[model samples]
Target: MEILKRPMGDYQTNCYIVKIDDKEIIIDPGMGATEWVMANVKNPIAILNTHGHFDHVWSNSELQSQLNIPLYSPKGDIVLMQSSTWMPELPPSTPDIAVDGDKTLDISGIEVKFHHFPGHCPGCSMIEIGDAIFSGDFLFEGSIGRWDFPYSNAESMRESLQKFAKWTIDKPLYPGHGNPTSVRAEQRNVDYWLRIV
Candidate 1:
């Protein structure tokens, strides 16, 4: 398996491309990825989104259209996906597959799992493949996601953090922003946040 990270848009959102054998799956095709993907990827089978924030879904429609692949996103953040009061205009495309809870799916021959961790956004989620996890806005290297947005809930984030702390502590963590980290590292880094009420 090969994982490529491309930073896109003003936020430098991380767009991850997971390639296993001949099949490729894109995670968060943010702005400026259409051209890149067109020139680079091969045999893209599907798109897996962690959430619906603009920075994460900006190029989703274009990429999906161009690649002619299906897009899977959490059904919890449909409001943010449809319209964001703060972000620039975006192309709207309904998610081809909506994940509302923890589930495993097979894209062609690759197995991907989704875990809902609503906090930064109502539909915040993470995708696990092999020993790595694509942690959207839910958890970062040394910080967690912001719960001050419109549909965000602090309590939910805290609960998610606690839940995350209980998971296996040795897998690599690929977050939405910044460089990659690990579950054990994040468990230690996020200790302070978990202490909050």
Candidate 2:
């Protein structure tokens, strides 16, 4: 499996293209991502969203139309997927598949896992494919996602963090922003956050 990454739009949201054999899955196709994705992928299969935040799914509709593929988004964030209270100018897109919490499925022959962690938003999740986890805005290098947003819940975030801290298996973490970290590395940070709380 080969993963290609490009940060998009003003937010510099990291858009990823996970290539497994000839099938490619687009994850978090943010603002200004359509052109880059179109250029890179030859046999695109699916578009997966970590959450419904506008910055993370700006180019969702365009890519869906162009690539003619199904979109899998978190069921909890379905409201955010259709429209955003924060960004009314956001292009509205519909999800072909509304993924429930902690679900796994096969995209063609490849395994796609969605680990639900609702805190940053109603349906915030981390997508796992192979040995890497695409932790969209949840677990970053030295920080965690903010629960100060419109639909964000601090208590829920705390719960999610606790669950995350209990994880024993280590994997490469590709976050929404900044450089990549690992499960073990961020477990230490989770410990820090838990300590202060």
Candidate 3:
């Protein structure tokens, strides 16, 4: 598995392209980088959004239309996904699959597991592919996600953090922002946020 990171949009959100077996799976197609992603990868299987934030799903509709691929997201975030004020102009291709709890999908022979973890947003999820997990806004390098947004909940964020701490796999965490980190490192250093609440 290969992971490609591109900084996109006004927030410089990290758009990730995971390639395996000549098929590409785009995560958080932030903005305006659709051509860049398509040019680099062969056949795109689908677009997967960890959450429906403006910064994460900006290019989703465009990319999905261009590639004629499905879009996958959690079921609980449809409200956020439909907000025009938060998102740019989108196409009619909403998420074809709405995942709940833990579900796995095999895309072109590569397996990707979805883990529902809401805090930053009501339906935020993490994608586990190979040895890396795309944590979105839930867990960052040394800090946790902010819970000040309308859909964000402080208690939920704390619970999600604890859930993450219990995971046995110590894979590298590819968050929606900042540098990448390992699960073990986060577990050891994340006490700062966990202890406060």
Candidate 4:
């Protein structure tokens, strides 16, 4: 398994391309990755979006059209995805597959598990492929996603954090922004941040 991160857009969102041999899966194809992914990543099987934030899904339509592959996002963030206030210039493109609940997807033999976490947005989630997790805005190096958006809920973030606390604390976490960090590191940070937030 090969995991590559390409930070893109004004926000410097982390766009990941996970490849296993010739099969590839893109997670969060943000702005500025359309040209790069079109040239480099080959025969992508699908796109797994962690959430519907504009910065995260900026290149969804471009990649989906060029690669002719399906894009999937958690069903809960449909509202945010469609709102121009949140999505900016990128008009909402309905995902081919809307992942509503916890399930495992078999993409040409590679297995990806989707777990809804809902905090940063209404339909926030984390994608688990192999031993790596595409956490989107959920867990960052020493911080969590912003829960101050109009659609974002502090209570939901708290609930998600509670569930996150029980998850295994050893996997690699690829966030939507910033450098990747381990679950153990974020777990400790979550403990400290939760007390103040």
Candidate 5:
């Protein structure tokens, strides 16, 4: 498996392209991501979003049209995707598949899992592919996603942290912002986030 990451937009949101064998999966095609993704992918199979935040999914419709691939988004953020919650200029993108909480599917023979961890947004989740987990805005390097934004809930974040505490399987975590970390690495900090958040 090959993973390529490039930060996009003013927010510097991380957009990832995960390649396994001949097929590639695009994760979180944020603002100004279309050009980079177009250059990087060959056999693009599907577009996956961990959550539906303006900065995280700004280039969704553009890429979907260009690549002509299926889009899989968490069910909870459908509203956020279809409507401009944060940025009014946000281009509305619709998902071909709406992933309910913590569901896994076979995307062209590859196991793709969506681990629902709502806190930053209603449909906030982490996309798990192979040994890597694309944590959209859930778990960062040392800090967790803020629950201060609209549609964000502090209680949900706390619950998600509690749920994460029990996650025994550790994998490399690629967050929406900043550098990468591991599930185990962030797990150790979950307690701190739980206390403060």
Candidate 6:
């Protein structure tokens, strides 16, 4: 498996392209670099989002059109994805697949587990594929997501953090922003920042 990270737009959102065999899965294709994505993916199967925040989902429409792939996200975040004010710079696009908690999706031969973890947004989720967890805004390196937005909840965030802490500690987490970190490292020390929120 090959994972490529592209830092996109002003938000510096980490857009990931996960390639296994001849198929690819594009995660969070933010603004700019559509051509770069096209060059890498051959018969892209699905476009996955961790959440529907504007910065994270800005480029979905264009990329989806270009690649001719289905878009997938947690069911609850469709509102955020459609709201013009929330995602002002983004074009109109609805997810073809609205995933539920703990559901497994088979993309070609890769099995991706969707973990519903609502806190950052009502439909926030973490995508677990093999030893990697695409954790969106849920948990970052040495930090956690903020619960100040209208859809965000501090209690939910805390619970999500605690739940994540108890998860198996072997995978490397790829958050929406910042550098990647191990689950064990975040579990041991991320609570310090979560406590202040």
- Which stretches in model 5 have alpha-carbon errors above 4 Å? none
- The list of candidate 1 runs beyond 4 A from truth reads none
- Model 2 Cα lDDT, one tens digit per residue, 20-68: 9889999999999999999999999999999999999999999999989
Which pairs, if any, clash in model 1? none
Candidate 4: residue pairs that collide? 77-123
- What's the TM-score of every candidate structure? 0.96, 0.97, 0.93, 0.94, 0.98, 0.94
Model 1 deviation from native, Cα RMSD in Å: 1.2
How do the residues 1-197 of candidate 3 rate in per-residue lDDT, one tens digit apiece? 88999988788889999988788899998777787788877888988989888788877778877889889988877777776565546533378888776789886678889998888888889999998899898878887778888888888878887887788888999999989998898888656777765
lDDT of 5 by residue, 81-161 (tens): 877846899999999999999998999999998999998888999988999999999999988898998899999999999
Question: How well is each residue in 31-143 modelled by candidate 6, as lDDT tens digits?
Answer: 77576688888779999999888777777888888778899988888888886565565776699998876689987788999988888888898898877899899888877
Candidate 6 clashes between residue pairs 3 or more apart in a chain or in different chains? none
For each of the candidates, the C-alpha root-mean-square deviation to the true structure, in angstroms, is 1.2, 1.0, 1.7, 1.4, 0.8, 1.5
Runs of candidate 6 with Cα error greater than 4 angstroms are: none
Model 6 gets an lDDT of 0.84
Cα lDDT for residue 182, model 1?
Answer: 89
In order of listing, the candidates' clash counts read 0, 0, 0, 1, 0, 0
In candidate 2, position 75 carries an lDDT of 92
User: What is the C-alpha local distance difference test score of each model?
Assistant: 0.87, 0.93, 0.83, 0.84, 0.93, 0.84
Against the true structure, candidate 5 reaches a TM-score of 0.98
lDDT of 5 at 195: 82
Q: Which stretches of candidate 3 lie over 4 Å from their true place?
A: 84-93
